[model samples]
Target: MSLFLEYVKIKIKDFFSYRFTLFLFLLIDIIYIISLSVPFLIIYSATEGFPNWNIYELFFFTTTGIITSTLIFTFAIVIGLDITDKIKDGSFDLLLLKPVNIYYHMLIQSLDLRNFFPDFPLFLIILIILYPLVGILFSWINLFYFILIIFISCLIFIGFSGIFISFSFFVPHFDSFWDLFFSFREISRKPIDIYKNKFIVLFLTFVFPFALWNYYPASILMGKIDTSIVPSLVLMAIIFLAIGFFSLKYGLKHYKSANG
Candidate 1:
């Protein structure tokens, strides 16, 4: 944790050194996140709300998705994209020499401060705005579940992105996997319950598990499901993380260094 904090401090210093660029990026991040919610706002205002979902509930769902996506972008996809370049340049092997846990080192060192900032703070602000509407339902238990869900969501995201990142070890030019990954993750923008097809719902829930990133957690907070389901969710997250870890390890074994 201290190592992570040190990296964060460095990233903060570097970002602050260029105040104007930081401001511009922050502005862009805010605009991009807010733009995603605009469509939901339009839909809610224009039509009757979805059967079980009210506007606030849908807003919470959207906010969770944005947070999940942004956290993934900052932590995993960016590092995965960088890994391809590092492999091509024969710098990927350097990670093996680092004293820290390789996965932890990769994630901490790849901290992209700009990608994280305004989006996170913006979400907090949105939640603050939502408090008046949701305050009564915001029990300590709900907050605990929400935090747990977010932690698992991030793990699931990293695990999925790791699969793509692992390809870089075998194929140095595999950066396009991030684009494919992003396209799939965009499905999280809506709750799976809105879909009518059972198979599609199952696929989204388990195969890609995009629903975990937003819908399941949001539903839990909205009291649509019992907390007993959390254990299963935790187990699922671990499974995904294990798969991603092994995939990357397998790729490493197959890797032929660019320098060699």
Candidate 2:
């Protein structure tokens, strides 16, 4: 925790050093987040939105996506990218020799405090806006489940990212991998039920499991589904996490230092 705090302090100082750049990026992020809501508004304005989902519900769903993606980008993807770079330059060899557990160390060291600052305020704004529309559904137990699912979803995303980062141990140049992963992640932004094709829905639900990111949890929180599914979600996270762990270990076994 001390090490993590030290890294956070460094990041805070560095972020403040370039206040203009920080604000510029923050503005860009906010704009991008607003842009994501445009499609839903346009669709709803043109026609009835997304079968049963109202505009506010759709916005809620989008907010959850923003939360999940923002956290994943800050915690998982950034660290994975750093790990990839270190692997390419052979600096990962030194990272392994550090006294701390490699996973915890990399996670803390790669913490981009900037990427996390926007989500809380944005979420609060959304909650305030949504309270009138769907506030009746809110309860402490439901909120707890919602938060728990989001936490597991973040871990699942991190594990999925780990599976991709493991490939860095083999290939020297795989920078486009993150783009490919994000491209798939885009599927999680919308509800799977919107797709007419059963096969595609099943594929996403089971093969890729992107639905866990927002759909399942959002559905439960919104009272569209039963909470009994929480156990299943936890199991799925465990499966993915275990797969990611072994994949990383396998890649490590094959890794050859750049110095060699």
Using lDDT, give the best candidate's number: 2
Task: After superposing candidate 2 on the true structure, give the runs of residues whose Cα lies further than 4 Å from its correct spot.
Answer: 97-100, 258-260
lDDT of 1 by residue, 1-260 (tens): 88688878888888788989878877786687678778877888899867777877777778777776677678766777676677768777888787878878777756576767767777767766765675337678877897798788778767876787677776656776667656766766777777777986777777877777788777787777778868877998899899889998887777778531
Candidate 2 matches the true fold with a TM-score of: 0.88
The lDDT of model 2 is 0.76
In Å, residue 64's CA in model 1 sits off its true spot by: 1.8
Tell me the tens digit of each residue's lDDT in model 2 across 11-51: 87887799797778778877886788888889888987797
Candidate 2 clashes between residue pairs 3 or more apart in a chain or in different chains: none
What TM-score goes with each of the models?
Answer: 0.86, 0.88
* Candidate-wise lDDT, in order: 0.75, 0.76
Best by TM-score: 2
Q: Model 2 misses residue 60 by how many Å?
A: 0.6
